[model samples]
Target: MAVALQTLVAEAERYLASAKIHDYCPNGLQVEGRAQVRRIVSGVTASQALLDAAVEADADLILVHHGYFWKGENPCITGMKRRRLSTLLSHDISLLAFHLPLDVHPEVGNNVQLARLLDITVEGPLDPTDARVVGLLGSLPEPLSPRDFARRVHEALGREPLLVEGEQMIRRVGWCTGGGQGYIDQAIAAGVDLFISGEASEQTFHSARENGISFIAAGHHATERYGVQALGDYLARRFAVEHLFIDCPNPV
Candidate 1:
């Protein structure tokens, strides 16, 4: 029922191929806790609430898609950061975070999970030239109107997406989960009828309207909830350890 912390991290890195991808934050074990892990709590982000939930669950490790120490974030361990790290260290709960690797993994990636939930047949990468393409180009079984496509997204994600309608029905689509509105341009270049991402920017509307491609801003937290859970389930089955997915919903 228990596995060494090093062993768990090794298994995760091997499963995700984390070393092959370059990411803003370090992947694998970000913080050390107990040497052995029996229970794991997974979530979208490593927020204070999630840490508290993990502590309450008596989790030995916390696995997440979003972790601390980003590319541009302050390095100081103070205030919120200090408190979060303090809680983890105090409870001896290890933190294992995988960002870009989790997003692009073929089996359990966030985009793939979203595609499965939305019934999309993936065709290729949104940006074929990019070495690490996080977005996908795909198609529906049949074309749906912009309105109907938005409805499908709402039903699948359990959250109504902010829709920027285009003139044509959507057959081919491109998508990336979690703050991927920036990839709309790549999707447009790929000549997709619709593009979906977790968050929208001010210019996303204009880009959609100008380019004649529909856009959907599904909730970031909702879109990214799957990959971590998938990873957790995989770990549970592989290592014979208990896994819990704690939902600390973020509207943004």
Candidate 2:
């Protein structure tokens, strides 16, 4: 089965409500390929490994959370950029990416998906006052020690998270997927007992310690692996096109 590339992109844009949310990169249809798409390959990032896997799978379109043409990236498609762009152009594989939209979406968003995997009951946005922070507030079914919570995260994500244990048990929680260390303060202000993000800055440790809040820095790739897969499944069900999620693992 196959669907028109335009139709799929339109559905994704509409479903994600991408135009309503501002992002660091352009959302939807980064590179154009075939008019009709029979298979879609989804991943956390559009790294060379993912692209090579997509090529091997003979994917018609590549869907990802990370894409090209960022807000401050150099425009010249020279080194790695040239290789990636050439791969797509040579293979005629379309590229579709969504950034912030995929993070905060009510359905199939990274935060919400991670909540399900970690058994957190989502309460609301981490910072309702700040639209810039794409974090969520949630609670565990029961209060668990910081170490126990970290173990749960490790088991779920298949990666050991860096835990900065606070002086309290963890019940109320907050998290943002992918390099969201900047939002730790916002999460603290939200009054969560613990905060989780993909990366941590040097200052994050002091903030967590001083504020008596637990902190976890799960790998960025590890935390964001679910949303794209959910989105791909949605598209597959909607359009009857084949979907594949290739996890080109990243330690960072």
Candidate 3:
């Protein structure tokens, strides 16, 4: 089934409430392609591999969590950027990216989906006072040792997370997906026994150790893989269009 490109974009923007949130990159349609979209390919990032996969799949649109044109990035269309845009334009495939909005959505957001996968009971936002906070505070169904928690993360995400052990048993936890190690401070302040994020920084170790909070650096790509797929599935069900999630794995 084919849906108008404008209609799809509008529906996405509305569903995600894109305009209400400020983000580093523009949300909704980043590149205009065919007027009607029949098949879509979604992924965590719109890298060359994902675009190639979309092209191979004969996708009319590409939906992604990470898209181009970020704030403060070099605006020049040269080398990698040039090649990527060239491929999209040549194939006439639309690109739609949603960043923070995708991460914070209640139902299909990265943090929520990750929690659901891990059987966490969400308590509240990591920063309860901040409406825009992306990280969340929650608790496991049952407390588990640091090793067991790490093993569970590996089992669920198919990747071993870098573990910083704290307590013997972790109950209350906090998490945010995709380069959210900075939020460790907030989690610490919130008194969470463990904090999970996509990437780890040099200072993350010190913060985790000094604050006595367990830290887990799950792969950024692995942690964020769920949101785009969830959004794609929702769109597919809602619009009666085909959606494919292409996995172009990245360790970082």
Candidate 2 ranges beyond 4 A from true positions? none
Task: Report the poorest 10 consecutive residues by lDDT, candidate 3.
Answer: 124-133
Ranking by TM-score: 2, 3, 1
Q: Report the C-alpha lDDT of model 3 over 130-184, residue by residue, as the tens digit.
A: 7766999999888899889999999999999999999658999999999999999
lDDT of each: 0.94, 0.94, 0.94
Best by lDDT: 2
Clashes of 3: 0
lDDT tens digits, residue span 81-162, model 1: 9999999999999999999999998999999999999999998799989966599999999989999989988898788899
**Candidate 3: lDDT of 128?**
82
lDDT of 2 at 1: 97
TM-score of 2: 0.99
lDDT of 2 by residue, 1-252 (tens): 999999999999999999999788999999999999999999999988899999999999999999999998899989999999999999999999999999998889999999999999999988888788899999999999999999999999999999999988999999999899889889888889999999999999999999999999998999999999999999999999999999998999
Compute each candidate's TM-score over C-alphas: 0.98, 0.99, 0.98
Clashing residue pair totals per candidate (backbone < 3 A): 0, 0, 0
Candidate 2: lDDT of 47? 88
lDDT of 2: 0.94
